[model samples]
Target: MSGTSEGPTPAADLNRAVITHSDLDAPPCAEPLPYRSVFAAAPLAMAVVDPEGLVVSANATFGALLGTPAEKLAGSVAADLMELTSDARSWHSYREVLGGRQARLRCTRRLKHPEGHSVWAQVTVVPLPGEGRGVLLSVSDITTRRELQARLRHLQMHDPVTRLPNRTLFFERLTAALDAESYERGGTGRIGLCYLGLDGFKAVNDTHGHRIGDRLLTAVADRLTRCADEAGYARANTPLVARLGGDEFALLVEHSTGTEQLADLAESVLTALQGPFDLSGRRLSVSASIGVVERHAAGTTPTALMQAADTTLYWAKADGKSRWTLFDPERNAHRITRQALASTLRPAIERDEFTLEYQPLVGMADGTLSGVEALVRWNHPQFGTLTPNRFIGLAEEDGSIVQLGRWVLRTACRQARRWQLDHPDEPPIFVSVNVAVRQVWDSDLVTDVAESLADTGLAPHLLQLELTESAVMGSAGRPLQALQALSDMGVRIAIDDFGTGYSNLAYLSRLPVNVLKLDGSFVRGFQYEERDADRPSPADEVIVEAMIQLAHRLGLTVTAECVETSAQASRLRGIGCDTGQGWLYSRPVPPDRISELLGSPGVRTDVAGTP
Candidate 1:
């Protein structure tokens, strides 16, 4: 090759010839041919851009991505193809790569296409290895993948049937709101929740198929969402309505004004659900019970809030369905205490932490001690001494009453036997023990009483088993047979707390009951002083008189309970009540005190009201 004035010199030409020969001899196709083929046929849309961000070269794939011809893309700014390039932060990053400060840059962006369809592109740019300092760009369409991921996320956070936010998302949003409120200055904003359960939903599920139930749930969700939207309009942080699985739904309201607003929302929800639902030509009516809890977000957690809501919901159901109940701290504390006592009840029985106190059942005619009622008390380590009123219902609920009742029966019999042994001269004083309804049904009461009497050498007649009037009236089959067997075995069965339950006097004639212990309510009216000297005895006194006469006719002795004052005692005595048991005579005292009373010659008639 000859040297030209404006072209390569002889040495330069020689160098060029050597480089071309090396490239031709190295491999089969070692030139730019393979790279060009890959750039042309690659699935990814690719381009080359100059330092100013203008497109220098574009491939067919790149043209197809933007809905333009490859030749027409040249000289156009590459940033213009990406919708997000207009953002300051995105533009800054783009400038960094184009200025050669960044070796490579990758980002996801929305790309505008001429076909009027937007595309999501994962764009990657790297500096080209040449003097021009251009960048090679690659774009991947991730629209379908992104849409699929979004759908998966929705499925995870929403209920499939109701299409409402599920418990997971509800908790997440609640947590987020709580966190945000915590970071606020001064006092935190209040947060409120409405936990709702559909009443008689299980009935619907049982009567109708699950498919119809599902449809009903969907309809309920729609109605709830509309109510939530309406309630949340004037409030900040729109309430998040969610289905917490199976006929239970929740509404989370952040930045609550007060309980008034929450109450309004709850009322609105109740009203919304009042209308009957039309499901596939079937009209179904349903109601809901809502528990509303509102408090400042400072010390609240998602779990604690939800727990309070759950407790309140239970109260709503208990108080009667189709109503809303607000969270009351005092009531919740009482419930929690009851639950703690319940959890410790079985263990208490095992540990022998129970003790019996006896209150004298005295003769109203002579004001002398006749028998003592065995009242069980729990010597709880944590709560000190607890009365039956605090824990008896709890024991009955957990089915611990059977064991507890047996223990009481055996203990009372043994104590009564001891008292008789101590005072051989004194008349045999009976020990009346209260029997729970569950103990009657779940336990062999006749056997228990017989064994106790046999073990202690005490007569069955001295160990009276007192059952509530309801228990006696409701007894049938085995329970009735058991009662009859006990009655035949010479064990006295007194109907306790008479007139407090279904007072069926006709049914009383059938039961083998020997005594009727009138309920405290009948005696409470006698507590009031006689304001007018000429006025007739109070209605309660007349009722007591009539009941006493009726019991006398039935050959059943009548005992007055909870006589707090001497006046009340005097009236009960005047009404022909056979016996009296109350704080007026003596509070429930330990066994030793009872021994002293039994040994004393004259009856201790000094009356003292309950403290």
Candidate 2:
């Protein structure tokens, strides 16, 4: 049998030698011109072992391989000389070959030399061709081959830029750390990792080139390695710093004390990388965001750990760069839920799993229904009815807002026209629909509004479009043109969540806006019982009143949002606000419920919950 390692090369003087079992009578030997001469002249490390497991004869090559003289090796135990029985499986196979119960045995073994260093040998044992009693053992030197393989493996497992372990090796170590046996080495039984990414790195690459980018990465790696050394718990417990491709790196700690250790390591990395790097007279400064994850090694897979680290890293970036974020299971759960929501949002639109709930926007003075705001609610099959706050940002990100906004616009218009038809005797109630910035830019807002009004027979004057100040503050070019076209078509425009943005209020007159719906935080201050008329009002009350007067002066109506109590409503009315919408009137309810409340004052709060 041949081993995975290369076999021994034969010399021109190679000859076959056979011997009988030492315990039995000698077998007939033909043309035996002294078998020892043949063994002595062999180039390979050849040894003849008797059935009783003693070295009967060894060639000079075999003696030199084990560092023992051939003359003295005659009576020695061959297995002990080579330490062949160190493991059970190999020992059993050797015994089988010695007993002539097996045809052959081939295996690799590391044999220690008397001279300090070790030699790798491919050892093969076979029964002499025609003889039955003894086995011949051949050991070949494979140290050079093994060294070449080691060099190739080293090149394969490391990053060229950072000269650090690459993704493959990092994951390999992480997986090994979680192995059950790893915890037995007197540890805290927990593993931790700091997954980091450079901030604004692409700008550096695009500005300079990949060569400079690689140098920056290498510099970052050196700092990380130094950090790992300083944070080392012991001589053998230093953290492993690895380059995970591109501008990402990871610092892994095994037997971690706790999250605090991981945090310290992450903070050190951030601080180390903060200093300016002068790359070939080009000064460059950069920051990093790191995600830290530390937990018990048990029951954790490498993939799960990395996923948590990735989520935390994203949070660090989103919360702003140059900071480290620790993994929060609850936050991670919410993130997972959001991911699930985003993946399903587009399909939900096509499935028609959405509905509009109307909240009455009443005349502040008369306490009568003036109009209703259309709020879209997702009737998710898995998560139940979800408010707009839960998924609107996701929709805008994925460009599904165009599809969703169109549906809401058409549905709300059709319902408004139906209400007008149902109550021809009462004054017509307008429907206010919120528009996302994406809808204005990503879709043709003018065409969508025009089509909805034309399709539903709802007058354009009765449909109001509400957007946040940030969405409409700096409107220009296509966005400004779109808003102008909508207003020219007679659609009322209101800025939703007003006063929350930092845009200039002077621009209000320049915009084609028709209304300002005050942010709710300002109105929450009105919760204090309405003070005497002459007394100074709360700061928020003063602010809201000033805003209301400003809007009125600009010829734009004011709608005070989040008027949850009668006191808040009365104060808004006393302040001369044009309209009010909140729980004080009624929570957003189904369209059918709106029909029931039509032609009536804002009275019922019968809905068990608000969307």
Candidate 3:
């Protein structure tokens, strides 16, 4: 055998050796190496089998691979040694290779070893060129390599700490489900997701160490996994539970029945998390808010679905944590609209897309228009003219209210100054601007007001700032001082939407407030047809009367809001309400329309009862 070849011989050489039976069976000699020596000493695990599939001879490497001695491996049935041969297809392949129907066969299979553990190997069988029709079999153990590859893949797909599927795998599975043929065919293939956020999870890391937090997260992952398994057993498809980064987990249901099913899953998750967690000899409790989104799998992208889920999750958090919220398309559309508005706000201010609308505040006693509230409107190209109700709160949330509010103050002051010049003969009508709480605390509101008055040349007395009752009630320290400075500068301060908030009447007398704008709820009570003498006034009449008396006693003028009927006006006047602001005077109109109202002689004559 020439001192044994470096590796296994080629297939052709093996076939030639088998054909020359005399040389293969010859005993080894010192003169030269024999074929049997090379075959026995080959590096690869190899064997020679007869046409009956019996192992006639096997190399030492083959015996080692099978956990048996070389001599004992002979005469054993080769098919019985390999566990994969139990499959019908593998048996057919073995028969075909031996019967010469196939020249060569190669397959990867799990082979049983005498030591009890299974070995993964690549098995190749090639026909020999002998009359007996023998075959050469080769086995290569690939268990270690396969395990390494599997470990790398597992690391790629799962979170290291919790050992759960990560966001990458979750998204991949979600995309596959959405792209399934059943979904394309519009069958009953609906998908659902429960996007959950652990409430107050950051506090755990803050109070305890991060190690404890990590252990708590592992426990959460385990609970979520069990819940997913339980849910899967009850349904046709298995649920995928994944950790979407810190403190967030998601459950993917591929074949969701309906919204009810998703809701039930969310409830189960919440209930599971209700129990306290035990970590490092300490007990900790945490709750979760889940956003459930269920819809037809077709015509939806992963991005859109996740966005909807995120929005719904915020809704769950907002409505109070530890609860589940179902996705609402209409509500989502509204929120998207608001977000679009918020995104456009800063740019709109730069582009001067905002314009002012003024509503007349009529004196109830003389039916004379006393002032106008400077209401802001957005001339949105896509949404048309939008009221402040649509975007003011959004601006406040994003901290852009300060800039937007400043713009409004300057613009309204300039417009009011123009009106003062245009209607010199009319009584000075103050322009009341709505001030957000953020504007008061986060901005130099007094400076902004002073600058607006100086730049627009409008008198400070003619500029009234209206703060919500809640904003005023919560004002203290810097905010209260800001209000006081603005008031001392002769800028009138009015509490808008009165009676709807804390109504801290005890603190009311100390504030620099000059006016109280009664909420619409109190005014809506009297918005009806004139009652007969026998009929009594509505119940709100007493409330409005008492509020008006209280305001007068506090030296604050009373303004009744939402007075849309003649009876409402009459009652407000009877209760000595100083001013009435509502559609009864006029819906908020353009600055030009306010000029028209100021110029019109019938402005006072067209009272609610003038008809």
Give per-model CA RMSD.
8.7, 4.0, 7.1
Output the number of the TM-score-best candidate: 2
lDDT by residue (tens digit), candidate 2, 395-490: 999999999999999999999999999999988899999999999888888998999999999999999999999988988899999999999999
Per-residue lDDT of model 3, residues 114-190, tens digit only: 67898888777777776665778888899999899889988999999899999999999999889967576644689
> 1 or 2: which has the higher lDDT?
2
TM-score of 1: 0.81
Per-residue lDDT of 1-611 in model 1, one digit per residue for the tens? Answer: 11111323332233233333233235645666445566667677888778888897788999998889988999998887865365676667677767766655667887777778888887766656544456677778999998998899999999999999998898888898889545385333888999999999999999998999999999999999998889877655578899999999999887788899899999999999999999999999999999999998988889899999999999999999999999999999998888899899999999999999999998888777889999999999988999999999998998999999999999999999999999999998999999998997898888888889999999988979898887888789988998899999999999999998998877878889999999998888765546875433577667888889989998999999987776787778777889988887888989988888875653454535421
Question: TM-score for each prediction?
Answer: 0.81, 0.88, 0.75
Residue 543 in candidate 2, Cα distance off native in Å: 4.3
- Worst 10-residue lDDT window for candidate 1 reads 1-10
Q: On TM-score, who's better, 2 or 3?
A: 2
Residue 403 CA displacement from its true place in model 1, Å: 0.9
Error of 2 at 78 (Å): 2.3
User: What is the TM-score of candidate 2?
Assistant: 0.88
Cα misplacement distance, residue 551 of candidate 3 (Å): 2.3
The candidate scoring highest on lDDT is 2
Q: Please report, in order, the local distance difference test score of every candidate based on alpha carbons.
A: 0.84, 0.85, 0.84
